[model samples]
Target: METKNITGLTEFILTGLTHQPEWQVPLFLLFWMIYLITIVGNFGLIALICNDPHLHIPMYLFLGNLAFVDTWLSSTVTPKMLLNFFAMSKECKIQFFSFAICVTTECFLLATMAFDRYVAICKPLLYPVIMTNRLCIWLLVLSFLGGLFHAIIHNAFLLRLTFCNSIIVHHFYCDIIPLFKISCTDPTINFLMVFIFAGSIQTFTISIVLVSYTLVLFTILKKKSLQGIRKAFSTCGAHLLSVSLYYGPLLFMYVLPGSAQENDQNMMDSLFYTVIIPFLSPIIYSLRNKKVIDSLTKMLKRNV
Candidate 1:
């Protein structure tokens, strides 16, 4: 095994969204529109939070990071998929190193955002003190660092693998699942690595979020005014929506065993996380946020 020559795979053939020739154009247009909206919505949210003074709280700070992550996350897979949709033949080479970087970064960013919410809700009195500007900046830096660390390890393992035969990946992008399917060597170690790292991150983050929300609920229930409880719940509504969208498809895709039917089902679920969720996240956050609406209204009034 040590003496085996590691030759770089030249190209990979992506099984585009659908095999049907008739569906190509329609699917292309639909995802193209979604990609455009995702970029605009996420960037708009980031700009709104950055430029507006009133939106400088920990919540909005986290929202801005989420927007930034969503922007890159969608960019990583959608553009390539869109281009493939328009192509006559779906052949592409995903630089494994580049893909490893993208996926790892996204995972860390999601975990960081979960921790931000935990701090904001669980320690409201000390939120400002605990999540100072310096601290937030450090958190962002650490998130990226965590991604870099994981990506290095993942890519290193991938580089060691010898792929001499199949190069066709049956997915829209360079995800680990599809990539593992094409590996010529035994993938038990690779599968275990993904299970340990990805699974641990998801489980730990979800636990923190659940604990934070549980405490928040208990606190809200203690308030005498129903209006206060309602208001608090409304504030958290968008976060809950985001959490569900992100975790739901993730659990479905990663936790379950891949079967013949799972391929198509997984692709659709991948669309939910990669396309629909990113596009909807900013809109959900903005619409549910009273401050964002007020700020936008004031800006429009001043411009008019």
Candidate 2:
């Protein structure tokens, strides 16, 4: 009954990643460099893949999309975070909505990439027939739509909650967990929904990746050529490292007990996925890839 007198929240005060004045400038500069590199790396990858006819295969196509997603994923949070370090704080639904979509899409895309690897390595003879262009298009569409559906479900539930008291969000961005903690309304159902949808998405995607890699492993074991086995392992190694980096923090942040996810730790985890991963992804994909390097060298020579 006493709650009737309280006013509703129109805006939120984000506490951001850190409160120390001295750390703000350095952090801002660090993330500024990261954001710039992420944009350049991802966009550069996209351009390279799109222009090179030799790279017009399922692997490069998926890598291109992954780059695109990583760009948006970093953009959605890092700018806001950079501003927040200077005590400029603002919140909006668009930021969270976009971030949610990118995160989910990336998860599905990773799984799709894993399956692509499985087909290429485990069923090398049928790789061309099995991974048709139509199938690739469908997979991409499914990832985007899956992300859209997940985002809609969470946002719908979030709209029902009331924020009466503190408008100060404990983290840099407007994340679901932090919002839940600050809401005056009971977030039991929201948390439950997260457990169902988010958990299922992560679990399902991880399973696909694991199963695909396992099959690929078995296929490699049977191969007579040691060279083929090394090549197979090398191809999968980049993706495995990427998956570990991308999913490890997410599992820790979302799947684990809520008791373990303190604000500071959660912010750090978020930073790893949202900032560090995006910057690292293109490098991971391109560093050891002879084709990408060769294409780059050719393009540079032509321009020069």
Candidate 3:
């Protein structure tokens, strides 16, 4: 077995979204606009929840945290990608540690949001007591701590590996999958760690959300009044939509192996989670949420 301390590759060439020169400008503009919308929408959501007294419930509390996470989650990858697209040089240097931190933070933050939902829907009466301000702060703190811990472990392991081969990455950003592919050393530990950490987080969070929604559906069905059921479903529809989009691409990318599609297809699927999902989340959640809509309307009226 050959052991090397560090690889010769100091920088990496990212393949980005496309190879065609003609499409670069158009794609750059599109992603730039999407990124802008993502920032403004998520920022607006956080601000609204913080400023509005009526929106201080457990549900909007989670939404506020989600907005905060989305801000960084999108920022972690998209800005670099957009810059690379527009810039004369497409190659960039990404610190393995920073990439790991952002990704790990996103994963845990998402799981925490799911837990918030579980508490709110599964136990409505006790929701306030269970997800109190103190508890919510603790949850957020723990999620960040957990993310930092996981990122440190992953990055430590990655930094130990040598990458003497080609420094070009097939994806837009410093994703774990692409990182693993370029590794010149044994990646068993890295693979196992990713499988264990990522799999456990996704599975556990999705299971909780699934179970909570199941109970919610049962409760709604048991209600005799059609109007009551309709209203209840309406309340949950936004969450359900957001959860599905967030989890669907994740499950596809992380849970399953890469054999399902070629590299191009895989990149497209990855885009769903990275770009599309982030953009869709605010739109779906805000549009489906009556409270947010009303809050926005009031804000707009005040401005007008």
- Best by the lDDT measure: 2
Among all candidates shown, the one with the greatest TM-score: 2
lDDT of 1 by residue, 6-66 (tens): 3565467777778888988898899889989999999988888888899987678767887
lDDT computed for candidate 1: 0.73
Stretches of model 3 off by over 4 angstroms after superposition: 1-10, 86-122, 258-260
The TM-score of candidate 1 is 0.89
By lDDT, the better pick of 1 and 2 is: 2
Q: Clashes per prediction?
A: 0, 0, 0
Model 1 steric clash pairs: none
Q: How well is each residue in 1-304 modelled by candidate 3, as lDDT tens digits?
A: 6655456444677777777889989999999999999999889888888888999876787678777767776877788777667552333334445545555555655656656665665567987788888987887787777767877776666665677546778877766677677788888777788778777877877776677778778777887888977877887788777777777777766666555666787778777776777777788878888889999999889999
> Candidates ranked by lDDT, best first?
2, 1, 3
- The alpha-carbon RMSD values of the candidates against the true structure, listed in the order shown, are 3.3, 1.7, 2.9
Against the reference, the lDDT scores of all candidates come to 0.73, 0.90, 0.73
- Show model 2 residue runs off by greater than 4 Å: 1-10
lDDT of 1 at 88: 29
